[model samples]
Target chain A: MPSIRLVDVTKRFGDITALDRVNLEIEDGEYVCVLGPTGSGKTTLLRLIAGVIKPTEGEIYIDGEPASRIPPQERNAAYLPQQYALFPHMRVIDNVAFGPMAKGLSREEAYEISKRMLEMTRLAWRMNSYPHELSGGMQQRLALARALASGAELLLLDEPLGALDARLRVELRYRLRELVKDEGLTAIHVTHDQEEAMAISDRIVVLRDGRIQQEGRPIEVYREPNSIFVANFVGGANFLEGFVHRRLNGSSIIQLRGGLRVRVLDTRFNLGERVVVAIREEATGIVPSSLKSKGGRGNLLPGRVRDISFLGSVVVYEVELVNGEVLNSKVPIQMDHGRFRVGDEVLLSLNPEHLRVYPYPPIGLYRELEAV
Target chain B: MPSVRLVNVTKRYGEITAVEGINLEVEDGEYLCIIGPSGCGKTTLIKCISGIIEPTEGEIYIDGELMNGVPIQERGVGYVFQEIALFPHMDVYDNVSYGPRVKGWDASRMRRLVDEMLNMMALRDRMHDYPMELSGGARQKAAVARALSSGSLLLLLDEPLGALDVKVRIALRRELRRMVKELGLTAIHVTHDQEEAMAISDRIAVMRAGRIVEVGTPQDLYLNPRRLFTANFVGEANFMVGEVAGSSGGEVEVRVNGEPIYSVRSSLLSSGDVLDGGRVVAAIRPEFVVMEGTDGMNSGFGGLTDGCGASWGGRVRSEAFLGSMVRYEVEADNGVLVAVKLPSLSVGSGFRVGSRVTLTFPPRHVLLYPYPPEGLERAISIE
Candidate 1:
């Protein structure tokens, strides 16, 4: 049996559907992240798994046992929240040991367990300090230590590092994963941060409007998202509206709305079928329109630079194609800086390997394209 | 005239010194960003400049005029806060026009100005949308337009884009910069994000414990930092211990783990900066180090002769796809793990863990700082 399972679980807050028929399965010791922006019902899903809330319709099972039959306290799952969730009045050690002590461990045993968890989170030095005395990151680590000290095989984290700085978030996310795996814990973390979800999770469950949009490995969702939402949400993507023109050599030739032809793999489309071709911002290389690139170019589109911005490690060039299709290319900072400017004509070479083709969405596909 | 100047500024709250004595100059129409970690007094410095709070012991000047006693409004400075404070009842158009209306501008002029500001922010289409109906990014743009509508001589922004998503922040920061530069509005922005500071600023002031540690262009801070904090804060760097072996012409030979490593002697440093056999730290960006012959689709790197990148063999320890860049941790022969960053575009990230490869980089990107550096541990805390 999977460690946890959700069979068409749905939750409603009066009229609004917070989570709509969400189905998922978490294997033993697997790290899964429920990722979505605000109002996407990520928290509702985590709460449902921890038995904190009941589904308006459908079932949830933990360890092959129906979860609704179990009370929240009997779930034996540790829940850490975005608010640090530490006892402000208690010292760090006591807060971490609170779980073990309440779960019937001896005083000495609880202390011992807390100490080990603290060391794992690098919060051993602050064991004697109160929660308010620690930095935001330190407090977050303390919360993780508390969750680990509880001896729960399943750990549920809700936006665990939302309050920390960017640098601190990067450093602690890996540490959190290490602590979870080393303890042989099955974890389900929820967050809105795309980078945070991609950095630590073994599997990502993308949710929107109370339903699972897509679920896959982080890289899979990023490089080849199954839908338009996943592509734009996980990473920056360029969407071009096109139709399948023909099939040749195990690939489909796509014709853009402007009559430019490009080749793409995965031949699951019919002739003249309208599709949206998704290309990642970093997959395209830019060059002056006058010079041809040595890299084999299968799809070169000429465009005038519409906008360019310096982003420290990278430069983002927003090129508007001659046919008025806007595409973005992210060039690394190490590349020559003065290559292209606004109004300068440039050619974007798109590699076919990075192209992802999907049937045009039923509604609001154009709206989402502009948002991406 | 200089847009703003801080002379020996310091702010103390009770027994704690929020900002130490600091001096800085902002040129007219310059986008200067002040950045540091929490408790570093970035907020206090911004407040002192904007007259929200008084500096305990220093002088502030705006446009060459002594502004020590000038009121916040009379100082001709517009301060946008971290959180968007839109008038809840007003629509986007009215919220933007509120500034001009408050200044008693004629109805026609106010309407025209609001339209222009909305067009510049790309919010003209959403001019009729309420605060609740707009996304966080749109609301933020409305707030920026409102600040711009005030038409102050100087703009003080305190992490205005801090509360948005990564992609939204990236998009809005550039727009903010474009609007600021197009309007020729001198601005001072404060943020804890090094990337944000580097992206939008004409110059950056790195703060530590409320004091100005260093101020320079983003390229200067990224390429040749005067201190370890500035280097690590602005960008990712691999810090390794080394000793100066010999110097000749434009290159200096530094020894790391008994291996000769040539580094370009930075013209920014004093000529006698490093003496022979003196210990120092070599800081280099991960992207500067080139991994040799990574030809497969996994990583499109290939064809580098021995002398191209001061070469060394290393095994791939681990790798991660950080969206924009692929980070590979390589364990060198000396038992040190060097992190290399490759653009996520061309490189297919085919490098597998445990693969053997050679690593090398040009001597010019290497930065050698004095060993046993003063306050280095405190400045660039790895934790």
Candidate 2:
């Protein structure tokens, strides 16, 4: 497996910058997910690494060797586009064996490899079926089998499971991870799905506006996002605008609007500095007003349940605070127990450790506030 | 406002039956969501109600008035397509005012109504910008504003928010619900997204193969789904084929591959209705299944025998980290692989692959169904 690296990479389409001074290093045999929204240059970055697009500046290296001079065919990387471009007229086995045949492998050898790959992708039974005859998931598996048959050291997957349904996506994600690990292939997957990236990636690189916003393990990125964009994009977070009141040992106490105080575990900002606290819905616990007498360790805000929504396994409660701020809390739906209904008085407590504090305001809000 | 009703609705396109004999009713001012996968007749149903397509055999009523002869323009209903279909050359203000202008409303009245809609959708600042200049979410809001400016009492939205991202979808879902309720307008939204349907709709009608599988409030549909299709499609479910063993106290005990699972009773099922030791299927949600280690000694066995839930032994196959919770795929010796989700904070990440664990699921959380339903096999085959 080859480790891929991009140093000071810059790409521009006319006057628009697609990638700006991007520096990324993917370790050998590591599953790295490049996550970004649509038109965020995620696909451009993958194409650059695959040698399909040349960077306007800087160089890309594979296994410590400069790869800019190499053509896509010689880059030893398999690129799977979003639309799983399987050969429409070819059968599943023929599509998978095309890669091996292109590399001058004997017909018998290519067929053997193709058969093994098809079996691995659970498409053995459909080997004789044409792409048009197979389901979407099966066609995608054929695409994957072809990519594997290419004998590439690094795999570039751009929204590999984007076209599948949710259940099929979940099942394919597990199977893809297993395939990558079993083959010890260095894979870089680009997608906008936070759940898919988190479920399959060993590490995630969150990109926005053609720049790296944050890069870390999925759990770490979700728990402690470095910027408001990362927090809001990765998961649903309720942003509370506040200013740091005091700095305790290894923590900061933030006083939000309406004098509601919240203790955050991070001390990245100085006292009296403006900050934003991102509290995930699942981390916020709702307690009865009568239990308000019992003090809690974390920050507590009094609010009224504005709406109660049941979403299968979880119940989401939208609480409107005294300051007119709305916060949501998600808890596992307990059918036997009585749930909190709308218009009920409730207290929402945020665990300091679960709270992630960012020094910057949200992207759009920042400009709006600055104008004021 | 009008309460819309469809009786024995059936639509056909040549040889294809687009909509089967489906009956549904939408109360006045109620937000109803028609949810299903692509080609499941959700959009066709919406078009039928919008007067775009006449049903092959059925009667549509609006406030007790038959709507078969109603033209598209005279239906007094607003329609929003999945694609914005905005007049790209027109500015935001003109786009919203087009409906009022076509109705020959005075300029002053049209301006006032359009302005109110723009403000409600939070598009006031972008009134001067063309459709292409606005973002996906902004364009969708603009389209909604235009649809509502006609003062239609009934609104039909066909995947209005399907093009936006997750964050924008959530925000717009809340906004749409608030706007619908605030205006006291009866609306039917067609979408394939379960979260969007659950988040905004007062009631959900889940469709399958052109037929209505289940219709209920989001809570009722989520909590007490009657059929296996409803249970699996509305949310995540682990289905296991088993045999009916016995019953007691509003519960039925099912035996699957020598493992007993307790399930709540359904009106379609009974103690004697299921032949003794007859084959059946049990569907359980991941949230209902709790994992306990063997070190707890009697803890695993005790929790099951206490009547709180049913317990079974399984080996952990893999764990997927999903932000707030870790989902584990466990393989039971009974030939069923079930998923269990545990809160990240409550459970330590120590379970290794192949480690045997016990899964406990409450009886109320289980949905029992007969084995091999007719249309269910077709659905699985399509998958």
lDDT per residue for candidate 2 within B1-383, as digits (tens), equals 68999999999999999999989999999999998765679999999999999999999998888999799898899999988888999999999999889889998988889989999999999999999998898999999998999889999999999878776788889999999999999999998788788889999999888989889998877777776777777877788878888777777888878888887644556545576686777877776677777656222223333366777888889877888667788998777789887666556566767888888877766777777656444433323
Worst 10 residues of 2 chain B by lDDT: B297-306
Please report the candidate that would top lDDT against the real structure: 2
lDDT of 1: 0.82
Which DockQ values do the candidates obtain, in the order shown? 0.49, 0.46
lDDT string, candidate 1, A231-284, tens digits: 888886888988999988789999997788889986999999989998888887
Error of 1 at B249 (Å): 4.2
Residue ranges of candidate 1 with Cα displaced over 4 Å = A100-127, A135-137, A243-261, A266-273, A292-297, A334-338, A369-372, B245-250, B253-261, B265-273, B292-315, B344-349, B373-376
lDDT of each: 0.82, 0.83
Q: For candidate 2, report its TM-score.
A: 0.91
